[model samples]
Structure formats: C-alpha cells, structure tokens
Target: MKKKNDENVLATNRQARHNYEIEDTIEAGIELQGTEIKSVRAGKINLRDGYVSIKNGQANLSNVHISEYKQGNIYNHDPLRVRRLLLHKKELKRLAKEVDQDGMTIVPLKVYLKHGFAKVLIGVAKGKKNYDKRESLKQKELKRELQRNFKLNQF
Candidate 1:
C-alpha cells in the first residue's frame, strides 16, 4: 500500500544493512520494461543481490530479479536483466567517485514505487568486518532488551 508520502515499498534488501555499513543513500529512478513493472507491482521483485555499478557515466542496476508477469506473453522481460538507473549528472559523478574509494561499493537498499514511478534506493557502503557485525548484533540485542523492559515497567 502507498503511504501518505506517495511511496509504496515493494522489496527491501535486509541483508545489505547486515553486511555493509551504509555511508549514504540516494534515490534513483529505474527503467523497467512493461512486463517487468507489472511483476514488480505484484511484489515479485527481489533486491537482495542487487548492486549499482557506474559505467560510461551512467548508473546500472545489476543482479536484481523481477519475475515474469504470470499473464505476460512472449515479450516478457528478462528476470535478471541489468537495468539502467536514472540519476543527475552530478549525482552520478559523486556516486562514481564514492565507489572508487577502497572497500567502498554501491548497493541497492530497497525498491519502491514513488508517484507512479519505480525507484531504487542505492547506498554508498563499506563492507563491515566480522567484529563490526558482531558488535552491531550485540547492540541490537541490548536495544531490544531495553525496549522490552521499558514496556514491562509501563504496565
């Protein structure tokens, strides 16, 4: 369902946060074929393995899967096709520069529909170390415990 802000989240890459420390996020429009957008609207899209690559001054989304529309015929789009992402020239240059840093990469955080257009939220991220991942887990558990205790005390 679309929110008051006119965004309807379709798919999220939950593992992206667990594996990478996001430095920044940018929203970019996605170019989808007719059948592909239909599959996306039906929630048959997966962003888990998607990443953004900037090449030839353009951003491309790779490894994302949008299943074929069940009702689509011979012109159905490819499920794992690399799609183009639309970003301004300045944003594209910035993203390209950010990705050139050591251990830095661009990952797709989520796919959502905004104002009738398909968009992808891409993040500039650095892969977390094993220790960093464990620390984050510990912090999450602590936060959960605190929330539970607070709720108990409220009653």
Candidate 2:
C-alpha cells in the first residue's frame, strides 16, 4: 500500500511554474460540498489548467476538476464549477491590485489535506516571456551539467 502522503496531495498545477514566475504565495480555504471534499481526500482533484478570477470584487476559482465521489449520485458537485476562496478583505484587495497589473495572475499551485481540511496554495505570479522561459531552461541545463561534472570528479 502507498504511504499516507500519497493520498494527501490531491493535485498540483505544474504548468503554473513553467508559464509564470511565482512572486508570492498565500494559503486559502475553499468552499466545497461534502462529496467534493470526499473526492479531494481520495486524491481525485486536478489543479492544472485551473485559474482564479475576480467577479464583483470576490475571487472565484474556475476550471478545477474535482472528481465525483464513488458513492455520490444526486449530491455530486459539478466537476468544473467555480468555487469561492476564503480570503480576508484586505488580502483580496491586494490580490485584486496585483492581478490588475499586466501579465500578472492568480493561480492555484497545489491542493492538499491539512489537518483533515482541504487547503489551496495560491500564488501571485507574472507570466514569463518566451525568452525568459528559454533562459530558465538554459540555467537548469547548466546546473545539471555542473552537478554531473562534480559527481564524476568525486568518483
């Protein structure tokens, strides 16, 4: 059987890192139904391709897929429904300000179980240009080569 941690991390948006340079992060609580919460606990959630949008001065998450519970039928929540995120008014204002800047966005980084409750790690990020992404890739390759050379010399 897998470890407990395997069932804890429901999903992570890997594209968030590659597509944007994460500037800051904050944890937020999400409003979820009973079945949705159960589905998340069973590790049936996807954060990739999910995004946050502000409507009427409130933040809402969209495109997040939380699989239906095995036993849930009529009570199942929509897989891609927009869910509200719990944030302080001041924090929401700050996020709204940041999002108003060009190329900046609010994205969910990961969803995980915290003390029996589901929590989301949201990040304020700025989209990177093609050249910026290339530079990051180059830096990664250089780091890998340096590590390889050091290991070979040690052996």
Candidate 3:
C-alpha cells in the first residue's frame, strides 16, 4: 500500500507565480463534496484563475474550476462554486491581517491530494509590475541558455 505522506498534485496555477510575487505559503484542507472529490481525483481541476478570500475570519476559495464527474447524474457539483478552506484560527487571523495590507492578496497556488484528502497551497502575494515580469522572463531565458551551454560542453 502507498503511504499517506505521498502527495498527488492535481492542478497548479502557473500564472500565479508570473503575475504575483509570493511571500509566504500555507497548506489548507478543502471542503469538497462527494462529486467534487471525484472530479478532483480525476485531475479535472483548474486553479489558474482561482483566488483566496478571507471573510468573517474564514477563508473561502473562489473561481476555482473542478469539472463535474461524468458518472454523477444529479449529484454533480458546480464547477465554479466557492468552496470553504479549512485553516486554523491563528493562521486565518494572520492571513486576514496580511491581506488587509495594501497590494497584498491571497492566491491559490496548487491543489493536491494528501492523506486521502484534498489540500490547497495558498500563498500571500503582491502583484508584480510589468518590468518585474520582463526581468523574470529574461532571467529564465538566461538560465536555460546556460544549461544548454553546459550540456554541450559535457559532450
């Protein structure tokens, strides 16, 4: 049997990293319904446009898309429904305070299954300027070029 410590990533928000500079990350459980979990396990989830919102001291996930389970008839869940995130009181308070700061927001980084439960990795991030995005792209290209050159030299 596989160990529960192993994590199976379902979906990742690649745009989040490019658009926002993540400062800190936290792992929180997702309150998924029966059909929702089925869809998630099938890797039919999209976190690209998803974000986290703290309301009334609770964290809610919005805009995340989990496709309906084909086998589910009337039991299918809404693809774009707002789901509740499970977090500790202290963690929720900290996230709320951080979001209250100007330019700081919470974003869903990735969704995965851990220990038979769905978990989301949320990040505290600030929007990056266009210049910053360009610089990052340049850095990535440079790194790729360096790796290619190194590989050629090894042959």
TM-score top scorer: 1
For model 2, residues 28-121, the per-residue Cα lDDT tens digits are: 8899999999898888999988889877878899999999899998988889999999889888999999899998899999998878878899
Candidate 3 per-residue lDDT, tens place, 41-142, comes to 999999998999999988999999999999999988999999999999999999999999999999999888887888999999999999999999999999
State the displacement of the C-alpha of residue 52, model 1, in Å, after optimal TM-score superposition. Answer: 0.6
lDDT of 1 by residue, 90-125 (tens): 999999999999999999998888878888899999
Assess candidate 2 and give its TM-score to the true structure. Answer: 0.90
Candidate 2 error regions (>4 Å): 1-7
Task: Give all candidates' CA lDDT scores.
Answer: 0.93, 0.90, 0.94
Stretch of 10 with least lDDT, candidate 1: 1-10
Candidate 3 or 2, higher TM-score: 3
Residue 81 CA error for candidate 2 (Å)? 0.4
lDDT of model 1 at position 26: 96
Kindly give the stretch of ten consecutive residues in candidate 2 with the minimal lDDT sum: 2-11
TM-score of 3: 0.94
lDDT comparing candidate 1 with the true structure? 0.93
Report clash pairs, candidate 1. none
